[model samples]
Target chain A: MYDARIMPKPAPKKHLSAKEGESAGGRVTVSIHDVASAARVSIATVSRVINNPHLVSARTAARVQEVIRKTGYAPNPFAQGLITRSSRVLGIALPDIHGEFYSELLRGADAEARSLGYHLLVSSEPRREDRGPANGSLAFGLIDGIAVMITDAASNLLKEAKGSLLPTVVLDTDLHAKGVDSLVVDNAGGTREGVNHLLASVPASSLYFVGGPEENFDAQQRASAFRAAVAASGWKPRADQVSFGDYTSEWGERWAEEHLKATGKGVFGVLAGNDEIAIGVMQAASQAGVRIPDQLRLVGFDDTRLATLIRPRLSTVRVPMAEVGAASIRLLVRRIEDREAEITCVHLPTSLVVRESSVPRA
Target chain B: MYDARIMPKPAPKKHLSAKEGESAGGRVTVSIHDVASAARVSIATVSRVINNPHLVSARTAARVQEVIRKTGYAPNPFAQGLITRSSRVLGIALPDIHGEFYSELLRGADAEARSLGYHLLVSSEPRREDRGPANGSLAFGLIDGIAVMITDAASNLLKEAKGSLLPTVVLDTDLHAKGVDSLVVDNAGGTREGVNHLLASVPASSLYFVGGPEENFDAQQRASAFRAAVAASGWKPRADQVSFGDYTSEWGERWAEEHLKATGKGVFGVLAGNDEIAIGVMQAASQAGVRIPDQLRLVGFDDTRLATLIRPRLSTVRVPMAEVGAASIRLLVRRIEDREAEITCVHLPTSLVVRESSVPRA
Candidate 1:
């Protein structure tokens, strides 16, 4: 249904065209034709100059270029693409765009993409059912390269992308395709530090691990690290000490409710999968009169801005989200430029930031 | 310089071409030739079936289409754009890509744009001096419509957009251009509610307003509303009672330091222009040994995710950021489809979310 509030009233009387010299305010833009006329050159010669400068003679091209510059004529990308085969645009597919993490990534990628003389077309990963089978490489002509940030690489979308042979760089998720490049941060390293810090303040037997989605690559890496850290601490985590979360505050809250009721005073420390869950745990703990760092200590991953904003302040793993994003674009652009370049996986580093939430209260 | 990670290594041996069937993964995609061969039709006839079905006989078209469907051949957008002049792509230009506000807006717009069968190309507003005169309207040919979320509408980019004749929608900032449409939340209403809430918790004379950047449209609207609210309360705010910020947490922190050092204890209530500034104020207040709610009452605008995450859970005016974003896309699409459509200004509603930060202690 049309959103009426945002819809403009119909005006059938006036025909609006996107062609040149028909602005609503009567402001006319100079067109290629205007440049051609002013320069006394044919439109084909003008086109040849812009797309293939070497084709035209230096003297004639110079004169045409001067007129083109003076008239401010921008060639249509579509018309240019027919000859150049380069749209000079890149596409990025993310799961969604609401989160701070995704936005920061987009910013980094966009900055890098623009500096490389490319524009970014970003979209949520479309449902497989929504895209017709024939539309597998529909973006082929419109965009030179694509960077897919889908969490689940085994999905039909990724499978289709794999077969499409598009110059693609899979972010975070490990597809391990023969030719596609992959980029990820050192999830396990940061996660290990988070667990180690928690153990330093509390016995391993008293520390719990709150894991994120099972299908998540980062979650898997983090959970593995937590297990290793726990084993290294010479403690076997009880079944009840390990909980699963979907990387959300609500899940964190829900699990916290169960954990607090079951363990009561037994669990003195927790290493959450992410900051959202840790915050949720804090909220639930506060409501239950369990003071952080006094009754309980917690550490989270992905030290997003939320880590510092919460009461008691969350100590967590800091992922350089923007840099990861920039790095992903750099990888994808290289793939686009060199189709046969050896596949490379660049793993950026992550660090731990200790805050009040994970510290013993004075 | 090209980002080293994203740049391809020297490939003297490999010649890269983006033509059909050649994939980086060496996966051969089905092309129009495959459909033509399978359907027993000439390539021109197959192209006609895909691009201009009306020109082909119904029986022949059905045969070609069935083969096309069976083979799963996706027609390229560039090849199609050459004939149809429609890319089904929309461009969104924002001041920057960072921040929860801009991200939420983008999420809304991106979701809506996709649902309407259009992809979104997002870019930061280029520096005015960086863009060539011709580049100003270059997006006109690349995208069907343009939505700019820049705060300063007087920039050269907006001026060039005003005259481009491309269907455009300006968000937040009111360009008031004859042809462009605008969509914004009730900044004044939301700001007033925040201020009124603060005054209710403390004496009107004890309250202060922290404004955002002067060049920001929302900041101006909020500041004007703050002043009006104060005037209505029968109190004239001294010059020291109103401070300006750059809509950043750091600026909020900086201004709060000045306010506290100057007023000491007289200003117990504050209405911040946005959540970032409010968060800054909270940090500064905490550092200065001022307790929230009891010693200082605060209200922030734009009820971003930061509000709930922060200590005391900031009371804020909930700007329907995602909805505003969705509305902007809907408006721009309408304008593009019907250039004769009358201009529209959609002011979405805002509500005050009262949390612990604005409530006085018992």
Candidate 2:
């Protein structure tokens, strides 16, 4: 079907036609000639919208927008080192190869991509430094754009990948890098709220902030927020109260045991790194013969499935994982169909979904 | 890079390529060309071994067998239909659209598919009848083959799909339909062993089965196995000894509560349909002021992640979910690579993994 709907295209280069065997984030050689003929718009109008959007009348813009969305078109394949066009596949590079969260996220992305007549090619890096060719390999062969979720984007491979003039979305990372749209959970906001909920019910000093992997963006934000919240409350919570560990529940248990013993059963509260750690902590506390929220308050982040399934259900910061997945595909696909489509950084909100875990000062 | 190191020209139409893709029960499709090349003999001599075994020495057949193993070539896809060429996409239709098991399975399949240079196209059917055409869409041009978890199969679409010769793997379904390859768990074996383990110290006749969705093949097999085990022990178990319920934790609680009210608070020795049901049963017993194993012993199936995470760690039948995921993809990609590979049902072994849930039955 020839699409007549249009949207404002601001890129100087508007052609995004398919080339044989293109890769992700490559220069999309597809031009406005393709969109105009496919959408029944004049090439001149396409150019006006791409290079100079204000010049196009509102009616023409709307028509173009519909056409782009309908066709599921994408403009850049240069991120994958391909100049030819292939919009059928999206490239997603995840930081961790193992984990239910990333796997589920990709499932959500795959579902949306299929619904929109597209497919996803996922790549993963075993570690931060192993992020280059291993992850960049995702760009191989006709990818319309890139969706990367890695911690250390400063690595040369990620850095080069970042500067490419391709349509891209960054997940769970900083937006300081130019020419990319980032989608991040409100780490600080969620953590701050969680700590507040715990402190409101319990009055205690020397609250523990369990930090995740040192380089992790989410973990870093959460650690800082907990400390800041405690400071704002004018609590004399010891700086030594902060303990570092991975996000695994095992770490939570180990840390809690050590902290509890050192304190000799003194008044204490804990802000765990994530749900996994939170679960471990709760279990360890239970084993150590501690009552939850009554004698000691505990809070966790990333309200994962474990939060509810565990006993004395966890009160955590709910990460909109599925929504993030859905939004990334929506944003990426929209950009693909419209070379001139606006680049947006959509920040999904997080909330403290209180269950029976943490309670007020007893 | 020249794959021509051992390259041979495509054999003529008589190459027996079509024989590779069918049921293993049928004839093996080793063509004269195949055996002749493998034996390094003339086609005329290779033909003699088949038509006139006396004319060709046994030495030649031995050589041909060696080559077959080395090349790992078999013809099953040719026998199946649409064997030689397939879309790079493989379709997996899951019964339910949610849960960690499906998530992990999808990840495993996706990982394997990626390794084999293919991508997965997943579809979720809310109900059994909703399996075909996905949300009423007319086509599945997105994928070349189908993999179903079988709850949504067993309908007209399956009958039609099989006849159409779509390379299909029907998982967890025991239906010996004409063309589909079945991959199923050893449900009966696991349950029998599990019940035996728990019942060895306690009398078998005293035990009960908390069955899953009565329609599920695994659930049915498990219930059957438990009954048979009780019977084989030379004890006639009463019909009132067992309870049937959906394979959910909520049902577990409900059924346990009902059992307590019916039996007047003293029912022991329970085997759950799955871990979820077992968990629910535990909750119910706890609420009723009955302690686990002390007052009532429980056994669960499908040692999902929840098994180890919960208190009084679940004693369950481990389904090997990750292994199944890996195996399905391995088997599937092999089929994709060679249509006429082999056609035998794969039965991955299942076992009982005991932890803290069930205690000695009295």
Candidate 3:
């Protein structure tokens, strides 16, 4: 069904009739038909060339591209999407996008999506009711698929996304909902390594698990992992040893300060939920005259940039954040391309990096 | 014209004809028409209620929304965008989005766009020649307007965005091209304050300005500001005293290492283009038995999170990156709403935050 035509070149920037290219705003909106007509190719061929160039012959794609450049023909994605039923856009919903972790993750996701001929419509903030239903339905209508990084297991976005029946890949959350792919970091394994390292020197009774918000999925996983690690090491799990707060340095500092005041003086091992908390603990412990690796051995999760920047560099679990992000996109793309594909759950491994913060029991 | 009709409530999950709601994939795709028909309103009225609810009566909007919820209608954004000639999406192109500066900027931009009922299609990586014209034309076809953060003065993204005839806002670059709004940080004023702070403590001959890439707009401005500050202080500017390199801690460390190796021993003041460079200088100088504030006073630009986390907090100029991002989106949205709006340039102020890195002469 190729309708190839050899047409003479049209004058550059010439005003076209209302139906051909002129928009309501009187701008010369060069349509895809013009590009196809000038390139001597069918409209379907032009569409395939723009979207799936590999499906079209190299010579055909090259010729079409030349015409597109010469005519400055920009195919309206809306019109193309309307006909194909594929927006060629992916929605990325993250809890927040301010930190190095999130930024690196976005960078990886964006790079992967672009390579696959998809654009990312990123939403950083949580959905607010005041913005109306348009905000909630926006992704469902516009994007082919979604990749949601769920910090909280009880996220409304997750619930809504599931209810929409769209192909989705959930990150960091362990709740394996039906018909959704999941990619999570090995929180338990990583935590066990950290706890085992700390326990080699400090007593189990002195070890404390300082975690993020109780409702957070990652935090819960890390906390549970700590308890399991302690129990595996033949130590009874104590509720008093674990404290739940925000994933912030301030919270870590406050908890450490309170613990230091209550205990008066002694060596202790602390496993912080994340690096920020570890940094906070380090700052507070330093102020309390507790020298790291001497009086207060510590290990943090998510070996972020801060792990190295902090004095007595933090020894922690290194989560492949960017890789996690990329893998999620890969999984989502597979599901989108083949809706009948088997649902898969990927658990990316996390490794422990030793630094000045946690030296052996010399 | 308003079209409203009172009809019997339709059965939920009932099969719709191919033209109405069913797709070729045999999946139930609820169209805006079905919702409009079930809600007893015209398709245009339903569109108005979803996109511009303020224009529709509240009672009618509520009733339409209730029908949408009941019928599980997700309006195809493609169809709506085709009719309105507005994607309700803004494209953001940044040189890199992995750092605190960029992430914070994106956060502000995303939040602002969401508030105005627009989504952000973000691209972080530079355009590659191998990616084909499809990658370049993607933004023009998909987004209503664009906000580009040009790290280099000669960015292809800038050139292409300018030529796309789409409403555009440029950030961090001072090209000030026709028909494009520009938003930039006050690099000159900020650098002047930093240089002046160092001048008060050290002789002009001992002061050195370590800048980023020579071709970068911000770097060029900062270097110019440094030269002016030195001249205004009645000191002859020496070309050897200033250096241009990549904006990295490694570059800063290497530069300082070579400088120290050549000039055996002397107290000097260094003004780094960014905090990473300053941090590198600190690490190298410390290793070489040189002390901050006492032996080699330093000041950095872009007071990032690392500025505070680094020991002896970095003394630097704080760029309002998030505000810049938010401002750019606001400007882009205004232009998108009124394409004939006058091109504007905004220069946001940056302030000096003196910490422990630089202390005045006794």
Candidate 4:
């Protein structure tokens, strides 16, 4: 196991005769030819041994088998696929995999795929500059279906996916593209209800909204709903009340600090983009001697584990990330199995959860 | 764009006659025979259209192109691999994906693999009862290398991995298997230092050790280190002081509650197996009106995000999960490129972080 000098030898390409189009060795990258070369036997003999051992003498077959084991050669899957049309693998395209969001989605998707007798192949946004079908072909060739999640709907990350032409499910973004199924939460409705709850419970002079990145579709939807909710309540909420952050706790803390500094009133409420942002604001509030619920009330979205774990537990709108992931697999698998199946646009519901931070102590 | 009824059509397996196998159709499943059938031409004509398009008549080529577009058919990958030796993909085998730990590891591995021009195919541990090489073959066929993470070293999950004979890097578990590389944190060192810190800083009457599952190698290492540290400090730690729990926050809470109930003294300290467990203990202590660092001091391992978010931030050992993930990829890639590379056992160093929960206030 500790052999330091052993390096994998690269197999040189074989130029086969035009008549047979078969390189003297196997027709694949890890061809039977390499095994034959190591065994000092003809490629035909090796193939005969694997396909029909009876045709080859036992002694010769045994020698070839030893060489195959030493070389670590396996038969090409494309040859086997000729008999079985399915690859039994599914692909998931993530913009990035750093956060809790994508990991939860992955867990749900992996569990579902495994239960369905399939495995998941995950890839981040492809390098758009790579150019051409080759970039998509590597993943496309291995998976029967794919699920793509892109927060920025307009990003070109989906272009290669479109080029793959495999059955696909789009998560989070409402991409109204031909033949693409979508799985999205009711972001606007959830935000609207959460905002309404905050307004009814608090007597704050103004409600400040902390929005996520401008390009994020879900963020845009939540921001729009926030404004709509304020308008419906007959409050002329100022544009200055809204600030943009990157959906991180640090960003939330920075934006909240700026909001507090600019405003003269000591009493106000905040609608954070997500739980991380809310936690950051809470941390900052504690540092600045601003009491939660008493001095500043806050609400958050995506009731992640952080929501419940934080002191003065965050009141948030819960987005069922794992369920969305499971549903995406179910939909994509159906699309793969039934070519004529109708495209699906699934909008799962979200609900507002009341907790300690957003409500005043009795 | 919202049309929901469109389904992906399955590509039927192509069965070529012996005479036609001689045609340039490629002797694999989903061969040129299927394309020729869809194009209403001979398999040779279809092959000519793809390989030597200049030689084919323009009108016939145009008709074949239209048919190919309508059928959504592409050439087989094994045939393509015959020329391109690299698949440009890596496999990551995870025990589970729900926690922040695995997610952080994935983020690091994915970032590294992408930078190295390889995509990642992720899978959970295959069902042991599946009992066949076929269960893992789908991923093995697609990836150039693999990284496996198994907390339980005794698990039979590595059996199929051995069968595939792919280059692999095992994480967390220290299995001294031949040809396989291992990446592990210094669990014993981290825990020993943490326990020593808790003992020296606080005037606690006794120290309690919270252990994770018995099967987990990391948990066992940490527990061993805790006992060693106690003996080194000339303390007669009681056998009843050691308790086992799952690496869950709830379990941590339950065990801490039991410890508190059993002890007559109000002042004590805890060495939790992980941050989650520590956080749970903190919650239980808070409910019991116990003042942190005064009534009880705590130290957790794997200083995850949860450490800083809780009130009286947790003092813990920080495991560099991302760095370990990145290193695992580098080692696996080297092994894949050089089969004779020396098996590596990388022990990443862990640091003890002092925070409010463990440090006494002024």
TM-score, predicted candidate 2 vs. hidden true structure:
0.71
- Pick out the ten consecutive residues of candidate 1 chain A with the lowest summed lDDT: A12-21
Using Cα atoms, each model's DockQ against the true complex is 0.43, 0.07, 0.58, 0.30
lDDT of 4 by residue, B1-362 (tens): 75546755445443644224456653433456677876779888987888799989999999888866665567665555444544667888877533788788887887778667677888766455653554443367656778888788665556767666667788887654665788889998898889889888643248888888877888888888888888778876778767777888888889877777776655778999999888889988888777798879899999888888777889999999888888888878888888887888888999999998987777
Question: Best by DockQ, which number?
Answer: 3
**Most accurate candidate by lDDT:** 3
Off by over 4 Å in 3: A1-27, A36-69, A127-138, A261-267, A360-362, B1-27, B39-66, B127-134, B260-267, B360-362
lDDT of 3 at B315: 98
Among residues 3 or more apart in sequence or in different chains, the pairs in candidate 3 whose N, CA or C atoms overlap within 3 Å are: none
Candidate 3 interface RMS = 1.9
TM-score of each: 0.85, 0.71, 0.86, 0.75
What fraction of the true Cα-Cα contacts (under 8 Å, chains A to B) does candidate 4 also have? 0.51
Better of 3 and 4 by DockQ: 3
Fraction of true contacts retained by every candidate, in order, equals 0.71, 0.09, 0.80, 0.51
Q: Candidates' lDDT values, in order?
A: 0.78, 0.68, 0.83, 0.77
Instruction: Write model 1 residue lDDT over B1-362, tens digit each, in one string.
Output: 76868878556232232333455774345567667767888779999987688999999999998987776677767767877778999988887633787788888888788778788888877655665544542366788888887676455556656655678898886554554698877888887787788877677788888888787777778877888888889988777777776877888889888877766565488888888889889989999888888788889888888788667889888989889889999999999888888888888989999999989766
Better of 2 and 3 by DockQ: 3
Candidate ranking under DockQ, highest first, comes to 3, 1, 4, 2
Error at B67, model 1, angstroms: 1.0
Comparison by lDDT, 2 against 3, better one: 3
